[model samples]
Target: MEKLQVLDITGLSFTSLPLSIELLENLKSLCLDQCRLEDVTIIGKLKGLQFLSFLDSTIARLPKEIGGLTELRFLDLTGCTELKVIEPGMLGNLVNLEELYMENSFDQWEAEDKVPRSNASLAELKNMKNLSTLSIAIPHSVNLLRDLPFGKLNMHKIQIGEVWDCLCMHKESRTLELKLDSSYLLLEEWVQKCLQRAQDLHLGGLQDGNDSIHDLCIEDAEAEDGDEIDDDPKVKSCKLRRLTLRNLPMITSFYKRADYPVDLFDAQQLVFLVTSIIMNSVGYSPFAVNEATSLEAITIERCQLIRKVFDLEGLTTNEEVEILSRLRELTLSDLSSLEYIWNKNPQRASCFQNLRTLKVQNCENLRFLFSSSMAKALKQIKEIEIVSCDKMEEIINVQEEELEEAKSADTLNFPILTFLSLEELPNLRTFSYEKYDIHYPSLTRLTISSCPKMMTFSSSERKQQLMRADIGLQQAFGHINSGLSLPVFFNEKVLFPRLEELKLSSMCRLKRIWHNQLPEESFCKLTSFTVELCENLSHVFPSNSMDRLQSLNKIEVVGCPSLEALFEWVCLSSEKRQTPLVLSALKKIKLWNLPRLRDVLKSDRKVNFKSPCLMEVDVRCCHSLPYLFSSATARSLRKLAILEVSVAITYGA
Candidate 1:
């Protein structure tokens, strides 16, 4: 036991460390996490211990003897809920301590006697000047802040309870984070003092009052005029690089009032500002930053009363205001009342030119992501994701006037867009209401699911173009014209030209994958296609287009009960049938829970399975299929490495 260099008694039921533990003089690390440890006097005897952890334990008090561990460098007491008091001078002896974590550890400190004693114990932390990281709850007493060596210590990272309590922080400290409760009040003097020094500042639970940031600045300026000029150096501008405000229910706007000076955004060097659960006040916009050019990212979540993120009406100047030009990422989530990301302004569209990624989720009131005019200016956007928005009808909403103008134009293009995912939007009708030859040349992946009302993937104008192209459609099987009125794929236009993967699910009204004949160059790069729970879908691909899908390797169809066949071969004469449909790259096919499926192909025309890499065929619960392939096509399945057929009534017959 004396030779043991590491001791781990974690998750044990022991209430106290064994006295024999003191014999391990060479022990350098000790872990008692998730144990019933109420006493740790034996730990102090391990003079060589450098690391000590008591996470999630029931220990009520730390032994005063803990100061004797002079070699201790890392101490973690996180989640020790019962721990309330620490003896004075306990931490003063840990001169070599580099990191200390005590988050949610002391719950009884709110009582009278425990508060002062705990403050004194915390004051001892100043003696350990080597502490680079510290996380602790600051007491409400003013003397505790004055007595603590915050201005002298060189802590690079610190997390405290209240900002006002730690007003005396070291100006040289690089980072400070405050996690205040809802009841805590934010003083302007303390906030301005901290912002002048902290490089990265995070504030939470800042209650609203007349003492807003603008009011604070006004008071500070008045005081500066009354005082004599001194030689003491101070940060002239807001030096904070990152500012995060969370759970601030009282703050409605970035500024208290619209008439306030714009210097709040101009003077700050902030690169990122993230706010969550911060309600927008009745008459103010959530993002009122008009001159924040240095901001690179802005994320707002669960902010109420935010009808639109940017309020252009509040701006004094109409002259092409360049706001958030350097921003690379923007995210908005769970804002129930959010109607638009940015107010529909043609001039302000240029602000999003540098944005690379945009994500919006659970914004139920948002009818559209962006207007058509704004979409045109988002040339740098590489990825767009929208999910669980119940009211979202379109991604790029085109007004009636814009639709008329688009019809006269050549094309609507998303030049650099590579990834698009739309999910759980039940009322979505189309990507656009009136499409004018929409093109996505760089798009590689596409996903659409749970959009039951989405019958067609094309715009109303594009559908009319297909209907005008004279594509003959003689109603044949099942319900004839009773299916959805729109086609699953676009008619004459080639959407997602570079698309590599496609997923479609729960689209109850889908009838055909494509309405009209696609150009030979269409879907040339598509490698995978999946369709599931689309009960109204009858066929996977149109008749003669299989020859164009040379890159298709995998196909999956599951729970599509009305699907009668995989391909609908048009009235191809016997002479044309001689030119076999060859899928050169096809490797895998999965058909599951499709009760009405009869054959893989509806016609007797031969399909030449020329893919040497073809390996799998999985068919289960498809009771009506006599065979997956026709007699001639079945010969090709003999070379497959995996041919799984279960509960399929007559698969081999």
Candidate 2:
């Protein structure tokens, strides 16, 4: 034990440490995090300990003997919820301590008799001149802040709760986060007086009744030298790069021109912003006209009253027209009252020119993703995902007037889009309500599930393009009738031209995979196709479609009770029948729980299976098939490995 330099007993179930740990005189690092230990007085006996952690443990108090560990440089007690006090002079002796973390480490510090009168003040931290990082909760009392060495210490990071006064005055702190238990009226005063060069600021649990964020600002007070504080009392506007606001329920509005002379959004250097559970803020559009030019990312979640995201009504300058041009990512989730991302605005000029990813989830009131004008401007968007939004009727909502105008306009293009996913949107009817032509030049992946009412990809008879070069749209769109009516075209266009993998599940109303005749090169580059729980689907592919699926490696169909045939041959002519359809790259086929399936292929025309790479055929719970494959086709499956079927079927070879 004397030779031990490091010992990690993390996540162990033991309740206490053995006294033998004291014999480890050479131990330099010890971790008992997430353990069941409650008392650790024996830890003090290791004079050579330099690092110690008891994170997420039940330890309640530190023994006075712990002060003897002068060599301790790092100590962590994060998530020690039962901790209430520290013995007097316990921290004063650890003069070499460099980092201390006590975040959420103690609760009920105000309860009667919860902490001993002799308990040491956090002022003991003042003696640890070398401490550079600290995360601890401060009591509500102002006395704790007076004796603390705020001006003398060079702290690089600070995460504190129950902020009183003067704590923000530490100019050397690079990051400061405040988690308030209650509203503090002097918040603006502290920000104006101190926090001049902080790079990151996080404010949580700030609730001043019925007052918006605009009202939080206070005029700069005159300094003791009789000189008025600088005109802009905010943290040096160019220094703060990231800001977060969480659980500020009473903040009715994020910004108001009449309430403040200067706004926090005016910080020109800000890059990342996050707001969660800040219920009453109406929208973030205010920032667009003010200071959103440098922002790279933003996240807003669970903010119930925010009905819109971007409002550009107040923008008047040409520079404001280019706001959010550099933003690359945006995420909105669990916002029940969010009705629109950008409300109808004929004058809106800002564009998401650099946005690459967008995600929206569980926003039930949002009837659509964005207006037609906004969709046309997302030139750089590469991925879009929408999930569980019940009221979404279409991804891009176009007005009746706009729909008329779109008929005479050229096609709108998503030049770089590669991935699109829509799941559980029960009311989704189309990708766009207007008949505007749209092209996805780079799209390679698409997923759609649980959307029973989705009848088509678009309501208008417009040209659609999926430009995957390996298997271009020319292969699939050749058979599509531009004049075909609503729901059928929806099912027909389900498969993109360049799609290599496809999955369709729980589409209750889906009747056909493709309604028109099969093109000569249809699904030529497809590798895998999967269909599950699609109750109304009767057949997967048209008769001649399988002939061009040269790259198809696997097909799986399950829980589709109404599926009757895998392929239904539409014999075009005797000339076409003379040359049997071939699947040269086919390898595996699995069909399960499809009771009505009568035949794998229901064609009188000859079908050829020339795949030397063909390996397995498994058919289970399908009661009506008399034979798995036709005689001529079975003879050509040279590489067949396993044929598992529910009923004995005649095999020609």
- TM-score leader: 1
CA RMSD per model (angstroms)? 8.3, 9.1
* Clashing residue pairs found in predicted model 1: 252-281
**Alpha-carbon lDDT, every model:** 0.64, 0.63
> Candidate 2 versus the native: TM-score?
0.69
Measured on C-alpha atoms, candidate 2 has an lDDT of 0.63
The estimated TM-scores of all candidates read 0.70, 0.69
Error of model 2, residue 338, in angstroms: 1.1
- In model 1, what lDDT does residue 408 have? 62
Q: lDDT of model 1 at residue 555? A: 92
lDDT of 1: 0.64
- lDDT, candidate 2, 1-653, per-residue tens: 57999999877775557889999999999998988776778888999999999889877788888898999999988888777777777888899998887766653333223355567665577789887677666545333343354422334455566543233343434556566655442344444333433444455565445334442223433432232233334311223434444555444355444333322232211113222111112333343324424445555555555665664334343233454566777777777776777644334455677789999999899898877777888899999999999899789877665566665644667888888889999877678744566666577677888987665565554322211221242233233222222245333323345667777787765666665653334355778888888776778887657656778888899988878888865555777666766677779998988877887777665545455677998888887666677677778888999988875343342
